[model samples]
Target: MSERVLIPRNRGFLFLDSHPAGCERLVTDMWQACPGSADMPEGDGPVALIIGSSAGYGLAATLAGLKRAGIRGIMVSFEKAPTERRTGTAGWYRTAATADIARAAGRDLVFLNGDAFSDTMKNQVADLIEQRFGGRLDYLIYSVAAPRRTDPATGTTYASVLKPIGRANRTKTLVFDGEGVPEVREVETGPAEGDDVEQTVAVMGGTDWERWIDQLVGRGLLADGFATAALSYIGSPLTAAIYRQGTIGTAKAHLEATARSLNERLGRTVGGRAVTSVNGAAVTQSSTAIPGIALYTGLLRGVLGEDLVPPVHQLAALWDQLTGAAPSDLDDEGRIRLDTWELTDDVQAAVAERWEAATTDSIADLADLAWFRSEVQRLYGFSVPGIDYAAAVATDIPWPDHTA
Candidate 1:
């Protein structure tokens, strides 16, 4: 006889509202919904800041680092979907949920509803640091994943053009159109070379990351012994053309190189180090969108859950390194081989080989399919516990009281 709970934001769609307070409540709800065991452990001296702490792997990074490393710091994100004029965006709810969780834990959490790529938001974060917490941060995470960006000065738009590296590379990916597993065929390779590569780099590359660091340091807001890191990925050669060697790959290369440069600059003031983490492929919203990623992720998920650690766990290990408990050798060129344990040379080679041999007539492991389905569902905020799904809920949201 319970009433149904009505979520403010629509399910399965990315939405945003300008209200920061409601967004914070949504975040709290999300945190409560997650299984308690899902939280990573926090070591001593937990002080961290997470940029782009909203969805996908970015949210995982925030939770893992905070729970494991004990970093109870602020979170900043640039979610441009819902405004007060257009309430009930996914970000607004996510922010609301985040605030609730932080309050319960006696931790500090701040959600900035502006463009992370802009100097204005950066300035706001700087001012907040000065006014509230004495301008000191131990750990900084750069985990923004956007498909496009516009040059504030030139007014030119840059986007990540999904393309193949060399010639037209055709491959078979998983087709989930049906309830059963099927192999789908793709052709015409991907985006053309030259301009495609440059455009992709411009859109997804390291410029924004560099600017963030610059703003924090320039404002004298960064604390001593600061450590910063960004996430990256490298999949098998099947989609290498479209992923690693393609447009997105070029941007990642830029990011990898930029980390070293930023580390050197930050070394002077904060004696800080820049790290690049090669995260595992989880069933995140972004991963689902990438071409040829679902099948690989699905097959690897079951295998990883058995033998290897998950991406969240990998994040926890990385947090240990950031806090000086673990050695840097745990990572590679700022890239942590999170999937290496599960996707061992033997494991990955086997998956690639099986995928090549797999035909539409072939039957995949039923268990793998089920795991994939569950993971995808978990990504969308479904299957969450605690809240009464059938309870009558009000759609009205409380307005945010952002100081800035």
Candidate 2:
């Protein structure tokens, strides 16, 4: 292993590298923040298969499951490993670090890294379920967010785009590049073109999720009372045109529909339940890329200030409801809503005022751009407080070696 002082390779909100030690520290922090006894609880331990369990809500839900419910987890994800001169993806290090923490707490966490959209990966997880989990699953969380996906049957690739549905809209967006002040610029987002919506749906939709359930149920791997959730976002009206009313919205709608379909099948057969958990907007890799999201989330964070609930805590609350520790918050459409606090009228009113008041010079003051930028850095294990960037550190960190 080579030791070198490493810094962030950042371009605006996009980070190209992740710090291994920093990522480990993040995992440790989240683990400590989680509520539950560290010791694995008694009884036949619950089992979960979290697809895309590396970063964002997926990682949060993964930690919530392990620490809150004492679940033995099988996390499926795709992340690049570090090379000699370059750092691995944040999700890569996070998964490894999580495995380390889980092992220390005497929990079972098996991580399978590969293309999650592939049938090969499904077969791999299925084999593990049969061999290691006694062919039973208590929960299945799908939190995959990818730009493109290849159809396993047709050998076709579908790519998702961030665009409005019918009419293009112009909006002010916030962008952070390096240590400089965040840039506020007006940009016109175009409408989705031919096949754009369908392709986006194909990549980001519920078909893959349905396929996973179908396979598991067909194999009799789902336990009685089995429950599943796919993470989703229905943004504020400010972004409704570009997000909730856009191509991504179409995909998420499909996902929610899949949940209902699966709910029927599961309820009829194994007394299981399935639903989409509509999460609140925050600084995530996907959110930063969307044209107006950075500005919106920044203002939202600024207005909320100390009252802002981190995604992990919100997800922990979801965990509570999912396990029946509290009543499940189901909307008229029968989907769990984790964004209730974020989408309140008072909050939206404040955010809209700030949005109107924002300019290039006052953007930082009107919105929490600095905080949003820092959060993105933390996502990739950079800009974490207490980390000694001046000191040399190892970049070639190993993934936690384990097998079913």
Candidate with the greatest lDDT versus the true structure? 2
lDDT of 1 by residue, 1-404 (tens): 21234343422222122233333443454344343343445433446678888765567666665565646666776654433245444444565565555555655666677677666777878887777766787778888887887766577888777777767766666555434334544545655666888888887888888887877878887887888888878777666776898778889999989888988888876788887777767666677666777766766654455654555566766776787767764444655556566546877776776666655555265126666764554443433444444555433443234453
On TM-score, the candidate that comes out on top is 2
lDDT of 2 by residue, 1-404 (tens): 87778788777777777888888888888888877667766764689999988998899998988877777958999999888757889999899889987787687889999998998998888889898878898899999999999999899999999999898988888876566677788899999999999999999999999889888877889999999999999989888888889999999999999999999989999999999999988788878888889899989999998677777787887788778877999999999999998999999999999888888888868877668877888999887877887888887777777743
What TM-score would each prediction reach against the true structure?
0.82, 0.97
Residue 279 displacement in candidate 1 (angstroms): 0.6
Ten residues in a row with the worst lDDT in model 2?
36-45
Candidate 2 matches the true fold with a TM-score of 0.97
lDDT of 2: 0.87
